[model samples]
Every structure is written in C-alpha cells, then in structure tokens.
Target: MSEDFKKKFDDVLNKIKRELDSIAKRIDEYLEKGEIYRAYRIWRDAVLDSLKMLRNALNTLGEEFKDIKFSEDDLNNIAKYTREGIREIVDKLEEIGNRIRELRGRGYLWIWFDLKPIKDLFQEVAEEVNVTMDGVLSHVEKFISSLEKAFEDTGRRASQVVSVRIKEKDLELIDRLVEVGIFRSRSEAVAFFTRRGIESSKDWIEKALEHAKKIKELQEAIRREIGGEEGEEDKENQGKP
Candidate 1:
C-alpha cells in the first residue's frame, strides 16, 4: 500500500520531502544562532540543531517513500494507501505535535529573565504548529480528491472493451501509431487515445456531466408539470359542467 501510493505521487512526495528538509535546515540554523524565539515571537522548534523530534518527523516522511518507482500509474493499487498510509502519516505528525504540546507545559523553552512571555510564547508556538498541521491536512485532502477523480475516470474508461466504429482516417491514424511502434496494435492505440482524450479534457468532461445532470432534472420537472396539468384536466372533465 505504501509503495503503491508513493509510486503514483513520487514526484509530488519528493518535492514535499525536499521542502521539508529545507525548512528543517532553516530552523536548525535558527536554533544555532539562538534566534529561535526571536523569529517565533518567543520560542519555537527545530530540525537538526540537536533535536530528536525534528529528526523523527523528517525521517518518518523520507524513509517511507524512499527508492520508489514511477512505473505504476493505476489508482487501484493506491486506493488502500490513500486510506491507510495517509492516515498513518497524519497520525505520526499528530504524535509529534502532541509531544510538542506535552513539552509546552514544562516551561522548557520558557527559560528567560522575567518568565513573563512563557504563557504567550507557548500558546503562540502551539498555534503555529496547529496551523501548519492544518495546512498539511488540507494539502493531503486536495491530493486525495485528485486521486479519487483520477480513479473514477480510469474506472469508467477501463470498464469494458469499447467497440468504436471509426472513419477510415481515424483508423489510419491508429494504424500509424502501431506502425511507429507507439503501440502494439490498433486496440492499444485506440485505448491510449481514448484515455488521453478523457485526461486532457477532464474539466470539460466534468462540466458536460454537470450539464447532463441538469438536463435530466429539467426533463423530470417538465414531465411532472405535464402530469399535473393532465390531473387538472381529468378533474375538470370528471366534474362535467
């Protein structure tokens, strides 16, 4: 499950991991220069300037998807990962956050001259962590939504063999694809183009679907109106002046 999701979204996940590493390094620098609290309005977190939490979070993210292949583009393999693996990641992050909050009450980072900023700094830091976590969750949600749509589209396209009656020119184009070694046979060429067309015009396809639904609703409404009028006419006729 983990490997499957990682494969489909390897590029995205790599970018995210790199970004995390960059951010972690920046925070480590802050801890080194003793500017941690200054930047955070009081006190804050870290990456590798002597910290276990930061290492754990970064490692958890990186180690899971290391050495992944981009070979599998199918969603069926990743559907389980979408549900389980994603939750595992989110849960790991939440665990890190919970640890931070647990330590927040200890006045560890509260070391200061007057100790007046302790409460404020702790609250601010926790709030920042929560906000960051929220952003992560939101990004995951959007990614999952995209995967779901892709899965739905794939399912529709791959349900059965579509017997399409093509014009000669279209058939010739399919044959050309085969001739160029782009596909093994006419069936492969057709399937590839059919999927490609759906993918390329996915937005338009969604809009068309929306319009079709509205059209169905409109037809139903018109039928209901006609039925109501018929009921009125029947009542009048039965009443017979």
Candidate 2:
C-alpha cells in the first residue's frame, strides 16, 4: 500500500472507532434499565445489527490484508476474538433477559435488579468490540480505494495511438468545404459526411468540384461589392474638387 492510502486509512479508522464507542455506550445504558424482556428486545435487536457491521468490517480487513506485505496477525486475531466474544455475550444476555422475564411473571422482584448488572456487563463488552471493529473498517475502505486508483492509472498508461492518412486534394477540399460551412471542418466532413463509396465515384467528385466553383463565385461577388463601395467613396471626394 502507498503512504497516502495508509494515512487516509488511519484517519477514517479513528472516526469509526469513536462512532462505535458512542453506539455501544447507548446500548449499555438501555440494557441497565432492565424493564421487562419485551422492553429489552429492542436492545437485543440493535446489538445483533451492530454485530453484522463488525463482521463486515472484519471481512474487509481480511481481504485487504491478504496480499499486503505486512503482518496481519494482530488484525486476524482481533477479528476472530471479537466476533466470537460478541456472539457469545449477545446469546447470554438474551438468555438472562428471558429468565428475568419468567421470574418477573412469578412476582420475583429480585431478578429485576440482578438483570441490570448483567446488562451493564454486556454493554461494556460490546462497546470495546465495536470501537475496535469501527477502526478496522475505515482503514479497509481507504486501502481498497487506493488499490483501485493504482490499477486504473496502470491501464491508462497502456493506451496506444491510432494512425490516419488523408490525401492532399481531399485535405484541401476539406478546408474549402469548411470555409463555406458545407461541414464544420475537414476532419468532421470526412468523418461523417463523405460516403466512402460515393466519394470514390467520378460523378460525385465532379459534383463536389462544381460546388467549389460556386463557392469561389460567391467570394468574388463579395469582393466586387467592397470594391464598388470604395470606388463610390473615391468619386465623391473627386466631385468636391
């Protein structure tokens, strides 16, 4: 990976870590309230969703590190440990919440308070796992972007130029045609207007020559009008003499 990509990855990773911390903290607080199993169900769902994000982040890192020339042991370790740990904790929390619900229905007031501490423990563990996962994901995205750009640059450099040829007479005709707006320019006219088969015929060439003559006549007429205006001005000056 390039230095630029590394720097961007670090910055993004830090941000992800902070966001995960906030989410985990909120989850912890919600769990600690320990209302009924029905109330904690929403919290359970949220935690499950966050686990998906963590898993995705880990997968991205694994893929990114596969070809890199650095040690990814630490990353692999974190991902493996965090994924399993979070999954286990989530399962235990759900079980405890369910049990507390059963006890509450039986009029056992003690389970309600006991549930709160367990919820807090689950929340703290979640916070730590999420913070780490967030950082990893941000870096993964940055590295992927850099690799994509590098490959694109390589492709651009491999481009080759094409050769083209135009006859001198055809070139001159293109210029003349452009001057009269028959086409925008020689290249445009040749590219789009000139039919290869039709232009190859003597008849079509002759017709094009005729149009060229007509254009020359129009130019000459324009020149004569200017000359006639100048002559009129000269005569008017002589009349004053």
Top TM-score model? 2
Error of 2 at 238 (Å): 4.6
Write candidate 1's Cα lDDT for 149-235 as tens digits.
443343233222132333455556556545544456554555556656534644754465566667778999999999999999999
Task: Score every model by TM-score.
Answer: 0.24, 0.26
Across 51-141, the per-residue lDDT of candidate 2 in tens digits comes to: 4444454565556655545334444444344434444544544444444344333222111121233334334434454344345444433
Off by over 4 Å in 1: 1-6, 38-76, 83-241
| Shift of residue 77 alpha carbon in model 1, Å | 3.6
The TM-score between candidate 2 and the true structure equals: 0.26
TM-score (C-alpha, index-matched) for candidate 1:
0.24
Local distance difference test scores for all models: 0.42, 0.46
- What is the number of residue pairs that collide in model 2? 0
